[model samples]
Target: MYMPWPLPDENWFADTSRQPEPDHEDLRLEALVAQRLSIDWTTRRQQITVAVQNRVVILAGVVSNANARQVAADLAYDVPGVFDICNTLRLSGPRRSHR
Candidate 1:
């Protein structure tokens, strides 16, 4: 009698194995966002994190003020291939008092 080889586990061919790599457009978008944030004078570099997914960018972290938050959002929006922006940056700095 001849014996057949054992079959591999079903999970071995799961979605992870066929995962797609990041395309050029996605990389460019991430770079663009980084550059914009780096060069902008209004942004607080230490308190921001940038994430790019499916052409949509998510901005998360703490900022000095609302303007900084808006600046981040606008910078991300200007990048090509950016489908949408989700600005989740929180403001934690002391408010400026107007005399």
Candidate 2:
């Protein structure tokens, strides 16, 4: 059996606009979320992890308190691509005084 050579679109070679691919949107959104999270100095950004899928943001990790968790959620919301948020942050319990 013989296979014919594949035909290429005429404009494909001429177009050099360097448009972003579809999959790149996720990375772009993730970067945006990370940037927003970093902007807040109070929250422990290092302890949290952000997951973005289909425009929904899922925040997971341990925070010092409920307010910190909420702050993480709010940071996620500030990103333009985030459509919904699922906050899974856990509180680390009350801080005990060290002797």
**The best candidate in terms of lDDT:** 1
Encode model 1's per-residue lDDT on 1-99: one tens digit a residue.
998665775564457766677777777888889888988999846488887878889888898888888989998898878999989999996779999
TM-score for each model = 0.69, 0.65
Model 2 residue 31 distance off true place after TM-score fit, in angstroms = 1.2
Over the full model, what C-alpha lDDT does candidate 2 score relative to the true structure? 0.78
In candidate 2, position 52 carries an lDDT of 73
Model 2 lDDT per residue over 1-99, tens place: 998665674454566787545456777887788777777875745478877777888788888878888888988897786789989988887778999
TM-score of candidate 1 to 2 decimals: 0.69
lDDT of 2 at 56: 82
Residue 6 of model 1 has an lDDT of 56
Q: What C-alpha lDDT, on a 0 to 100 scale, does residue 19 get in candidate 1?
A: 63
Judging by TM-score against the true structure, name the best candidate.
1
